[model samples]
Target: MACAQAYAADTFVIKDIRVDGLQRTEPGTVFTYLPFRVGDQYTPELGAAAIRALFATGLFKNVSIRTTGNVITVVIEERPVIANVDFVGTKEFSKKDLVTSLKQVGLGDAQPYNQALIERAEQELKQQYLAKGYYAAQVTTTVTPLERNRVDVTFNVQEGGIAKIRALRIVGNHAFSESTLLDQFSLSTPGWLTWYTKADQYSRAKLNADLESLRSYYQDRGYLDFRIDSTQVALSPDKSSISITINVHEGAKYVVSGYELEGNYLGLDNEFRALVKLKPGDTYSAKALNDSVKAMVEKFGVYGYAFARVQPAPQIDRKTHEVSFSIQADPGRRIYVRHIDIGGNTRTSDKVIRREFRQFEDAWYDADRIKLSRDRVDRLGFFQNVQMGTQEVPGTSDEVDLDMQVKEKPTGLLGLGVGFSSANSVSFNASVSQDNIFGSGNNVSLSLDTSHYYRTIALSSTNPYFTQDGISRTLNVYYRTIRPYTSQGNNYKIVTPGVNVQFGVPFTEIDRVFFGAGFEEYSLNLAPGAPASYISYVNEFGETAHGFPLSVGWQRDSRNSALVPTDGRYQRANMDYSPFGSLRYVRATYQYQQFFPLSRFTDVAFNGEVGWAHGLNGRPLPVFKYLYAGGIGTVRGFQQSSLGPHDAQGNALGGAKMLVGDFEYQFPFPGTGVDKSIRMSTFLDSGYVWGENEPLHLADMRAAVGIGVAWISPIGPLKFSIAHPIRTRPGDQTQTFQFTVGTAF
Candidate 1:
């Protein structure tokens, strides 16, 4: 007992921590788990804490704390390292998916395995199944010890029957009828066409998202105090049926009252007051009121009030249900820029953005100039993120700093893909593009395509800052050959090569005016099945040694974001005339697209395109320049390049006029994290080609209904679709499929 007391009294102080049995981990890592560093007191609590912390790392199976009187030591027997990972009976996700999901919970390649990680991974997997309505799913994790202190893991999952939404019942909604609320929910009992929509499945994620949508719908329209009171989910005894209840609180609506303004406005009161778009007797809208305040502050910015504030005071008249707002402007400490910091660009050069800035460091701040700067940067199309922030500088009341950051993405792309169908038989295309060419303010692209009857090569370039004066310019050079179908195999090939340069001057932020001119030459070769109408035109007016083509266009693209547009309008109208070229022709095309946001995940887009080509100077327009449709970009249900005038053999004989329309609904993925990168879409595509005197008719046009999946992969966008022809003639096929390996634009 005396020796034991003496040994206990001589407690060891840690000289240093030496960790062993670590392969994938570092020694310093173990030190972070140790409570006592070098030259510290070690107690029983500290020893226990060290063991627990080591175990929490999920890197060890057994952690032992021992002390030999004056020398305390910690020893750990790490779990066998992961030698391999395998999945069994999992078709919902791939092996890489399982690996990624397991790694999140601590089990990964080259990492030590612990029972705790296995339990966590099992729980996660079960939760995922529950989200998909698989409440009775079973997941088992087995660890097999291997050689070299490693272990292999296998996850066995037996996903049972998926719980379905047996019924949907609404309770506690007194103001509105139960039927009204039921229409808002996407999840419902199976209907006659449930096999297609899958509304019968009850998903927790879907329910939660729907509830949020409901809340937003009420709040945005003046239910400022809307709240989701509670939600309850119940499963039947058999675990095959699920029931959900959502309780909501809809508060009373409030009206705006008259208000008065205070705070001093330095010689800018009239200008700022004019910005208040709201007046007395208007409905109370928090969104509109907030926008008015921002507008007032922005007006003050013109006078160098970078740090301006607008406070709105409202006086409510309960009896009259009217409200008036009084606004006050505070121009606090007009500051000059001291420094500017640019960040977040990993692949693009900083100079590329700095060149677009209209506001300079050390100059007085201007809101309009700053907004223009942002627009210029966003137009680059090479970044995924862009933000600007201002910070006040200490010790100086009239100085501030600005910081701008951008996230960069790949700027160059080259893609090649082929498609084969019964109609087209075989088609191939290649494209080389650079969105941001050499860090310069230009976009350049070259494209080539060839089939049995047609061949085309085109080069295009666009400069955003054309003349060092902020104007935009675009240049194009195209060489194309077309072989007309003939009964005697004597169809002729028309070769047309031309170049165009267009200069654009912005009329406003949303509109631009473009003017350009070019030269072209057209020559024909005799081939089989040549059409009489086309042959006469080529022989009369299409045989030109040199001709001049002049054009003028107007464009307005005010879409919020070009990659995935919502809530904006894109309009373009152009007319071209080649009077002196190999052929005398005049052509005109007009396109319009409008996007309406139905919800965060839903959008309604309407697009229409019309083209008209005519012969001039007593000659017919060459058929080689005729319009073609019924492809991925045109009508979706029919084979690509399959729409136009057809011969006895069902071969296309080009046309002079065309029109098309598109209506699409893009669906969002629940867990993909690729908000803008992956989307599922359904579209209705209709269009048809016409002869000069051919009458237009709804019956002659073909329409298709289809669904497709688009992914912005590392290489490029991968789009695949399967469509069915809704209106087809007896001889026409009813179904088709297509895929494109690049950006849809």
Candidate 2:
């Protein structure tokens, strides 16, 4: 009875309620948290609950509820709002990044201030530094009170030096040498190239990747039971260096006994079995097994089995040291594509992308067609990345939707450049090109080039899809003036202006045919020291000449990548005929290129080219149209345009027949394993040019061996080589080094 009286004394019926200390916070916000309102009965428990709820809002630092004569009074002290946030002494991370990180943790400006959040921010900053190998980094926070019930926050950071790797060791490596295994790791003890490659830096992510490489190396060599036992990373007492140790166990090697196929194979068991790369009595290889599985899965996907699963179950015979695999496949129900959604093309038109799609909507999902579509879009060279994903349609079991997400890259280029070459000495060039003009998938270009030997201005445009059947049309107009780089004692010049129109028709997926017609006018200027042959030609024909040139060509390309091909064949045959001109002749050229991949990072490439020009209607071939060899693109050991027949005055006279062959073994640059952007090659080059009536002979060929580097740099593509001529005559001009910059080869 005494407890009941005490509780009743603290209870009351509220007639009105009032909240105090409402700076920055509305009174209605306080009322929303109150448990009881006016005209409602309030007990001591209810009043205590209201006070707790208001404090939990984080807006108030203190809260008190009291009642006098049936009226409730709430007293609160609001927490100070953050007026500004700033950083000091931070260098490793940008200010925007820190602010964004803090905002994610509810510590930005205009938010209520709290000491706990400041501690969290400091801890996060330290963790970020630690990830970057800054073990001794420090962070401090400061809060300064300001007017209008606000405060300013500042974070000061001190980023210490990066911890480098001092030592690296491997344990229990028997089949392979320790040095050989260490060579596969990106991280290493300090070495000569560490300053540039940063290979001596200690990083958890790099360590993990190295561990995976180590595992793959063993597994690919028949070590079926290889395992990494443990890894230890230790830092020096001063936190300036780190040491890493990796322990591995290699079990017994095994050989493949046989393989079996299990599960439904869509009535193509023999086809699926033939896709296996493994053979009986061969060494066991995880890579081969994965390749066989991937091939089988893709085969199923070709038949519209979009959701297919293939698993390998290996059986081990420990006594015989043999292993067998049971490949199990479960191809789900055949799916039909309902829709294809394309996104991330902010500037390109829908038709521009849609025309490249080989897989149509409302069709059975074909993986091969989808892949072809993606490749075609990529070949347009207007996007940085193109990704495709499948989404299951809602309320449908055997239907799916495809989403193609592309990241657009700049396709318009306006460039001005200056360069130096052994042949031309100095050159200046300017160009304006738009590959995807106005997102209409049309190409337009205007260019001007000036050099010691040549000067030219050109304008060109192309429409890849001029018709619905994917035919392409191109138009080009140009005016060019050319002078011999070294003409003995003669000064001769030729000015030519031309316009051409061409059409490209696709005959097959990898083949195209082109036909074009050009109208050109040529004017010649000759000074003293001109050759007798040139004077005879001028006497026979007038100074100015006009011609109508017709061209036909065929090209077939099967390279996996257009920019850097590893395994493929490319062939081209072209012919040009001038039927109505003072110079009546026919010229033809054939070229073939073959690339064979030796491994994932190495390749052997071969190129052969042959050209011939003959006079028609008993007319002589034009001297300006003759072919010349020996340069960066021909034989690297000889001077540019210096490998042909010489005139009586010791000047270069280009030939009517040419032959060139090149063989190269290419690999990634040192310390840049598997990076295709920078490559090194050892090459053998042979080529020669013949006179108008000279017979082709292998004895006249010029051969050279060289080492070269190709780099796809940010500024442009660059190639340089140093060569030694194998056989040279007294008149042959030899150049030990040759290079080209700002060229796309």
Candidate 3:
């Protein structure tokens, strides 16, 4: 009894707790988890509990509790601050990726260093590897303590070669040939070049993916009840090679008899019935029914009923071998917006985002306004993603709040690139630009471009709201020297300085009109081999011309998102005429772009443009003012400015009138995890150019179809295309391919 009392007496009231090596964590953040307070009695049990809790925070290296007389001290050795994290042998994800993922699991800078975190991270990585079919992947993590109580972490990973689909066997597919059934799987036989292709060593992930592929394949072909029963992946003794076997069940398919509309439509029954597109004799497609319901919901939303709900009920008749769908609509009470919340903007100011909002506080919630707001934010091009949703404000029955989230992208960028084509020669361009411009709504860019035919240096700036009345202004100054490829000796240089100011006049919640004009002083020097047509225009417009290029333009863009548009039409029309000013020409151009979403990751775009530049009041069109085509933005199979008139030596003579038509089928790159960062497109471009007196000929027009890659690079969108001429004429130079930079369509 005496010994027990002595042991109990050794433990006393706690004095204080001290934390060391804390670089990112606050002391108060740690104190909340301690088991004993300053005046509370301390015991071995309590000390152990406190240590466990501290470790659970994942922030400490060592935790100890000691007592002296009636006072107790809780001493903690904080885990080293994560000074830096680095990864090697990783092309699968960017550095930002691991940082964000680790932060979510509480293992970032200033976070506790419990061994459990490291273990969890390792396991998670291995799981990801497994998902990628790296069955034998090995991952190891190491923490190296550095000076200043910080630490550097390295994830030593042996990702191993990706497992491929060596051999696939369909065990339960007796009705079909084994080979035929296996061919339906995306995972295929190991080619002789599997070292590079690596399509064959099977793993669980590949097997699962192939299972889904198989189900879809059969389902689309009338196998309504098709399913993958089970799959087995067997590995070789060395664990390097694998084989897979799948069991599937195929069942009878059904067709739709028709669709019926039920429930109240609030006097919109006929309107809602037309929204249902499913018809008799059509296959029983769940997807079709779902789409019909969603379309109806959107239709209701357009009426200011933002909280509409839609549900579809499908009825099956076994005897008749038919299916019928009944779509139900519920348009809830219309509510007004109380507030708008902006989130996920770590660097940009809220005003910058809010300025793009079309929906206002205390206004009836308009679904169109919400969509327009999202589109406007996306068009800013400052974020990789823009998402907006409504959050029902609790305790309020008549109003809801809006929350907009954005993922900021790098604003400052530097890049150097070079390209060569028959028309442009070897073109090298480099630049430095910042769109955000030091957190203000401004832009600054400097570019130095060199081509075999021309050399240019340009500086430009734009102030979004130069006069506070939303009057945006842009200033551009550039100097360029052109070396003509013409045999004639008329090569010259040009220097241009221009400024434009545009004002926005708001008309409606989602409508704005702007009118602007600019004056540019252009100094032109004639190049050699010039045609009579060209010399005549230049002689009339002359050496150094200063003109007020007056113009009025209007644009209306309605889309869900800008980078990856789901649905919208962008229309712009402008007319610029030199009336009583510098040069002698009148130019009018109009363009329309329509975006249709074929799927979540695919967009079909239709673009058309018409431009006419005619001499004003008997004055000839300026030579420099003529339109040039055949490049990234025009015909893809021809060189830059090569589509227009050409002299005997092939020097291009610009034209006064032009028309362009483009159709692009854009789809996301397979296996590229990023949805907006990259896109692959197949396009058809057709256009022609004609002089004022020259007659347009269909035989002289150009058309091409090809594939290209589009990347939303940090600098800007970079487009590279390789095309093949679809229609070739005899004696014509079949320009079969072309590559270019910037957004072409």
Each prediction's whole-model lDDT (CA): 0.74, 0.85, 0.70
Candidate 1 vs 3: which has more lDDT: 1
Error of 1 at 490 (Å): 7.1
**What is every candidate's alpha-carbon RMSD to the true fold?**
7.3, 4.9, 8.7
Report the candidate with higher lDDT, 2 versus 3.
2
For candidate 2, write residues 74-188 as lDDT tens digits. Answer: 8778889999999998887889998998897789999998888888888888888888778888889889999889999998877878888888999999999999999889889
TM-score of each: 0.71, 0.85, 0.70
**Residue 613, candidate 3: alpha-carbon lDDT:** 87
lDDT value for model 1: 0.74
Which digits, one per residue and each the tens of the lDDT, describe model 1 over residues 219-324? Answer: 4444556687888888988788888777878765556555555687776567666666665555566667788888878877766798787887766555564567
Angstrom error at residue 527, model 1? 2.7
Cα displacement (Å) at residue 125, model 2: 1.3
What is the Å distance of residue 666 in model 2 from its true position?
A: 5.2
